[model samples]
Target: MALKDKQTEKNKHFIASLEFALQGIRTVFKEERNMRTHSLMGVLAIIAGFIFRLTTVEWLWLLFVIFFVLIIEIINTAFENVVDMCTDFHFHPIGKKIKDMAAGAVLITACFSLIVGSIIFLPKIWQLFVTYFL
Candidate 1:
């Protein structure tokens, strides 16, 4: 669960920070189609985990995979937005390269997430198939 700040005057800055961070999440979900796809994937992963009756340790690792991928995806969105904001008319090679690298980062995270999901889910799914269909 996400940590919550105490509702006190002393915690105003912390509360505001949390709000800003949440706004980033909202922005990404609204503006990035890839973010929506990631959300769908996360939901499906959780549902599959429930179906497979994942161990606590496996669940924890899956949760880490979910959060890490989402975080990198958000960072990728932020990087692209910042690049667009900085460049106006014509494209700069450096900006293009930077944007490409940011996209590559997201792609790398996605590939890693897929590998982890396969490692965690594939054997369970295979067993289910063998037990019922094979």
Candidate 2:
């Protein structure tokens, strides 16, 4: 009976964690403009991948990049917000550097995603051009 109760409590904790995660997702979608933009870009990327008839592996790679960039952007935004909330315009150099570094991380992820997309799609695009024009 004690084991059963412990298992039930664990299940309840898992549910609560899920609820918290859902609330965070809602907050991001509702409060963060960049989150919305990233979501829109993700949708567009999925549509384009389908329209371009990407192979399963290609689609997987594209989706992986897209999700990675968006996740990093969200983390960067969260860090910036936390830093801003902690210091309200005190001109703290460390805080500024931390925020800048977070933004740089997002930028690096975005650039890498772009490179991955190009690597995955450029050959297919070139082949299509040759097939259509030559």
Top TM-score prediction, candidate number? 1
Q: What lDDT score is found at residue 52 in candidate 2?
A: 87
lDDT of candidate 2 at residue 23, scale 0 to 100: 89
What would the TM-score be for candidate 1 when compared with the true structure? 0.89
- RMSD of each candidate? 6.0, 3.9
The CA lDDT at 69 in model 2 is 81
Assess each prediction's global lDDT (C-alpha) against the native. 0.89, 0.84
Runs with alpha carbons beyond 4 Å of true place in candidate 1: 1-9
Pairs in clash, predicted candidate 1: none
lDDT of model number 1: 0.89
Model 2 lDDT tens row, 45-94: 78878878989898888899899987887788788878888888576889
Candidate 1: worst 10 consecutive residues by lDDT?
Answer: 1-10
Taking all chains together, each candidate's TM-score versus the true structure is: 0.89, 0.82
Q: CA lDDT of 91 in candidate 2?
A: 65
- Report the C-alpha displacement of residue 112, candidate 1, in angstroms: 0.7
lDDT tens readout by residue for model 1, 1-134: 33464455658878888999999899999999999999899999999999899999899989988988899989988888888888873588888998899999988888998999999999998998999999
